[model samples]
Target chain A: MAYVKINKDRCKGCGLCIQNCKLALLVIVEDELNVLGYHPVGFVDGEGECKGCKFCAETCPDCAIEVYK
Target chain B: MTTEAKDKPKKVYGRPESLKDVGFHFCPGCNHGNVHKMVAEAIDEFGVREKTIGVAGVGCGVFLYNYIDIDVLEAPHGRACAEATGVSRVHPDHVVFTYQGDGDLAAIGIAETIHAANRGEHITVLFVNNTVYGMTGGQMAPTTLLGQKTTTSPYGREFMGEGYPIKMAEMLATLEGTAFVARVACNTPKNIMAAKRAIKKAFKMQIDKMGFTFVEILSACPTNWGMDAVTANKRVEEEMIPYFPLGILKERTTADYL
Candidate 1:
């Protein structure tokens, strides 16, 4: 099984991960603001298993995503 | 998979040891952060973090010292190559590199850059080409594409006045001094991986004492490009890649004379 962690403060909310994730498991949490005042990426739980491909983590400019398998 | 194995996840990807724990000061969706991460990863992989010295050029990447936890020297605008030449000569055994932006490498420092490479300075150079002077509110750079609008090129970059976008990788590859020369981009996951590989190879070449090495990374400038992160990345694929062309332009296993 694979999962990912996002550091909210580190996230600049560029949405690169959201766009690049093959499983489409990440989304920008629009309702709340992170410490940096940008919409942080949130993992949609149980929707799909993260393949551990690390596409999202690699695509993240802010190094906010940490993938675990 | 076993339940215990599933429960306790092994970290597959995270921050590189060579990078500082602090968050980046770059704007949202800027490519500098990604490129910085790659460089740190390369340094960590080589186990040269302690001996590696970075010379930073003026531009967005001027704060390279803050992100990468390595000894760094700040060079004057477009003088990074010259500074790196001196540092590499002084510390012959240490791993030395210069991180420069397009404006610093292809514009103001063009003469210095060429001369250093021509002299076969034993150093590595990381050229971040975003095609615009990002830090100064998006002024036209030597690598700025034709028909691309910037603060200075309001109407667009015309061939008559601006000539053409400079191709640093191909240009530098022509010199006999360069051991390795490549152009890579961070627009997509695959490209990002390739960029990292190229950067690592460039470092390896320098470690092998081949000659001057260069890697030109095509990065996106979302804020300066007046586009969202995703769109700017798309522009890198659509516009930049076509003109710049990716892959290793030159690689030498042994010195030219040998």
Candidate 2:
């Protein structure tokens, strides 16, 4: 199983992580605005089946995402 | 969080210790943040945080000192290489590097950068090429694509009025003093990994007293490009990569020198 943490305050909601998430596990939480006034990315573990590829983390420009496996 | 769970789950990715606990001021999805993280990771991996001196150039990257926790000297517009030269000369044992934007390195500071590289100064240079002058509100830069439109070139860059984009990597590779030169991007996961490798090698070459090292990062200026972060990233992969062609342009080994 894998887990990911998205620092809400630091997220710029650029959606780069979501675009790179191969599993389509990341989504922009439009309903929730971050401290920066942009919608931040939310991670859906999807039955805890993350591949732990770290693609989302690596592609994040804001360094908002942290991944653990 | 329990200690057991913390120990059980291996952290795959997180902020490097070399990076300060502060959010970047770059626009959403700006490539500078990714590049900064890669640099910090390189510094951490090499354990050179204390010995590293970062020379920040004018432009958006001027605030590099704020992000990376290290001794940083803010150089005047386009003088990062010149200042880095002095820093490296003073402390030959320290790791000296300069972070510069396209406008700073390719435009105003071109002479300083070229001269430093020509002299084979033992320093590393991190050049971020986003095509336009991002900090100055998206002006036409020397590296701007011929047809690209910017605040300065509203009618689109015409070949007659503006020359073709300068290929800094190829230009620097022709210099005899340079030990390594490579072009990388931060648009995708695979590309980011490649960028990290290039940056690490650049620093390593400097540490080994090889000569001047350069890593040209084809970054994205989403706000200046007037595109969303994702679209701007696509532009880097689809447009910029075609012109910049990523890879190592030059590498000098001891065997070649001897």
Candidate 3:
């Protein structure tokens, strides 16, 4: 059972987490331009390859990201 | 879908979910950021973000609610302890902590801090002592040592003109109600690790329903110190350490705990 989990609803677009990720694993998914408006960033790919560093999860201005090793 | 990507959010350890989406108002090299990060880390490690109430001081960190994700209560320039007393009483089960600077805690609020620690209030105080008043321009503070120059004491602080710096941790250790009293600096990676340990223990003491626990962190204020960020860090090692020797002043473990 991993302890980290990212709450997608609360994710903000700040990339501080991306800066801190040493393993080069996190990429931001910008708003895809839905019918209503722009949306917050989401994990682009490599969800399973997370080293569980929690760097992005920790530095995220929003508690939108989670991690469990 | 590849780990080879250049941009990746590292697995940030010790991140908690209770913090909301807000940055901080501290300076670029201020130690408040480190303290805030450590508090959040401890909250995450202990799983107490939901039940932790952070009381912010009225110094440079007056707007600390911006960074920390928990429920932060802002206190007047020197009234964090008084406010924490009320908050802790209201929410006994919650972990209450206060983040304050030397001027806010050791100077203007010294009386409040002493009384609160003396009263054995079940709260943790994260005290950052940069040895000078950081906000409202640098000035001679109660923790400013002899010979150290400040805006108010450009010719070096005269013992006759300015009283000696207050050894807050030593003073508070005599109160008897204080459960943990440790001093750690943030001058290097080793000190950073030590600071983390002190922070973790302070949080744990509060969890065990212990009395007052105070961690004095020797921090740097490059802007106020009239030096660059790097110099400020080295000053903590060369100058500050000689005066305020770092170590666990008082610990209550088992035999000591009893």
Task: Tell me the spans in candidate 3 whose CA falls farther than 4 Å from its real position.
Answer: A1-69, B1-22, B254-258
In candidate 2, how many Å is residue A23 off? Answer: 0.6
DockQ for every model comes to 0.92, 0.91, 0.09
In model 1, the clashing pairs are none
Per-residue lDDT over B65-148 for candidate 3, one digit per residue giving the tens place of the 0 to 100 score: 777677899898889999999999999999999999988998889999999998888899989899888987989889997898
For model 1 the local lDDT of residue B174 reads 97
lDDT tens readout by residue for model 2, B114-228:
9999999999999999999999899999999978999999998988988889999999999999999999999989999999999999999899999999999999999999999
Name the candidate, 1 or 2, with the larger DockQ value. Answer: 1
DockQ of 1: 0.92
* CAPRI-style class, candidate 1: high
Which 10 residues in a row give candidate 3 chain B its minimum summed lDDT?
A: B6-15
Ranking by TM-score: 1, 2, 3
Root-mean-square deviation of every model: 1.6, 1.8, 7.7
Off by over 4 Å in 1: B1-7
Ten contiguous residues minimizing lDDT sum, candidate 3 chain A = A31-40
Give TM per candidate: 0.97, 0.97, 0.75
